[model samples]
Target: MTYHETVIIRAMNRSRFTVQQGQAVILAETADDRPLKEPLRDREGKIALSGLSLSELKQFMKSLGEPAFRADQIHSWIYAKWVKSFDEMTNLSADLRNKLNEVACLSALEIATLKVSRDGTRKYLFRLPDGKLVESVLMCFQDRDTLSACVSSQVGCAVGCTFCATGYLGFMRNLSAQEIVDQVLSIQRESGKRVANLVYMGQGEPLLNTEHVIDSIDTMIHSVGIGGRHITVSTSGIIPGIEQLRDENLPVTLALSLHAPDKQTREEVVPITRKYPIPELIKSLKQYVEKTKRRVTIEYVLLKDVTDSEEQARQLADLVRDLHCNINLIPYNPTFAEDGAALYDRPSRDAQVRFKRLAEGSGKTVTIRLERGTDIEAACGQLHNAYKE
Candidate 1:
């Protein structure tokens, strides 16, 4: 038999299979065919009870012949009180606590590494149940009294933005709603502060994983009680996903990563622009504004000698003006080259000021995003797939 056929046969026999070196190897027996006593175990210890909202938790308790009020107690302990362990919930009866320990888990992410920026920005590296690692950042601004946490939607990104470190690792898998929510809680615990705003702009494209991303947002707003207005989902112009967001009628702000204006220029910086061109993307953004009646924010990363030209700035202004959106200019963060040859340079201070002037001159609200946590590689547009390496 051919190698391909051999692999399929082995995969059919095995429950767990992995393809390596152009060969398929069976790893474990199929769960359905296995004996009841030898049930397949999740080696990663993923919490099966994750994604349960407060109401659902109550329903589950009722189903188990327990008091319905216990659901509210558990929800308060898990989210409002931010308790990590089941035993710490002193309000719950000892019997219920023991029953919960037998089945459910309270926490999903285990903090493996934590780095604090000099400016009081905290970056956390969480080790997931499956050994996958993701990063989240909490930025504290004293003047604004704002604590915003930047959370990752995926372990690595598929949209290969030429300047992004996460793009180099390629796409892994979409993180579950639980994994996404855990990042916020993990950072909140470490900082001992409540997150005022949540941005889905950390490591991956939020729109690419539309379902889980929406579910996570739902949990944040309804279950976790973070205001929908305070949440922002940033995307690299996934057109279909943008359309999907419009249908949801979610109040969260939509931020488009419009790194470039024209198709040719954008395609050079953002590879996904080839698939979903600027014209279609613009149409979708306009539709979104009309549907939601909320202004969109365009995120333009200024790369020196790349997209920071006067002509590019004008093009960006015209594009946002047509859509009636605001512009957030982010100076590129210098990242090490894949080959370790040279570091990518950020926009010069003068160029940034000039670009800001051009953008603001277009009668649109424009803000130059200040770089934070560059010392620890925790600034905007700097997260990469480091745990894998």
Candidate 2:
């Protein structure tokens, strides 16, 4: 393997991961997780026949006394053909199929609730095996022929950005890598359209759950056939996660949730900034660009008087002047509440236009994000489990 490829393998952050409560157990998320001593099982204790990486599947097939090549057939059947059951893998022997039914299961998440925006944005709340709920969004753009899914890496967020909705919910736990990918699959299964793009700008800070986030990206590309370039992982500026991702050397995009331009202001907007300040975050992002050769995305949320002022606009422009990045200025979505009142307001249209112009003048591309599901509080920063049951 190439040096970077070796680094990619090393960066998976693999460790001992326990499985379901009942019978079998296994270790096989990353290549470094070692050859398994037991069968791979989901949280329900059945040997999990779903969501295995290509190499892990091969190891699994070898364990069953099946030829390694059976991994190809199973991978193709589950991911490419989107089969719901092993019995549907007609190529497998009937005995193997019966055995699979007895000891293994295809764990698909149950849809707890679905909400549709008039703008064609579909938001779904999914119930995990342990009954924890997470949210995913599907947006179909007629103009671009793009179907994008915003997926979560954790159940809720720990970043605690003062202006974010999910921050109010606090952190529960990180979603497993399969749980992340299943969100996209669930969108496709329900909408009957392939998701052309993925944005990891959902409930949790994706980079905080670095290993599974990268693993999920691996499955999305190698198994589910999504292009690496089509995926974007957004972060709340975790320096360690940024450094780890830089080593992985994937072609996916990186978006920094730089809601403010300066260190103090950024710490106020993106609380993680206190840990990884603007200068340090920028240095890490520069290293990321040098490695991946991918332009970083700077996601800035514009609050009415706080971040939309002329001075802040100038600072925002100057901040990204030397970087290979674009600016996406998002309007404040009223998800953060105080005593039943929305805590922030969207900046006036004039301020947004002026800020975009200022940033564009810095030779960095900038666009004001169009509002999507504000009516249902499903827009950016609005992905807390509001529809939780």
What TM-score number comes out for model 2?
A: 0.89
**Each model's backbone clash number:** 0, 0
Candidates in order have lDDT scores of: 0.77, 0.79
Clashing pairs in 1: none
lDDT string for model 2 (159-241, tens) is 99988888988999998777888787767767777888999998899988997788788888878889988999999899999
Scored by lDDT, the top model is 2
Error of 2 at 342 (Å): 0.7
What's model 1's lDDT at 54? Answer: 56
* Worst 10 contiguous positions by lDDT, candidate 2: 15-24
Q: How many angstroms is residue 275 displaced in model 1 relative to the true structure, after the best TM-score fit?
A: 0.8
TM-score of each: 0.86, 0.89
Pairs of residues at least 3 apart in sequence or in different chains that clash in candidate 2: none
Report the C-alpha lDDT of model 1 over 128-217, residue by residue, as the tens digit: 777777889998887787788999999889998998888887888788776888788767666678887999998889998987787678
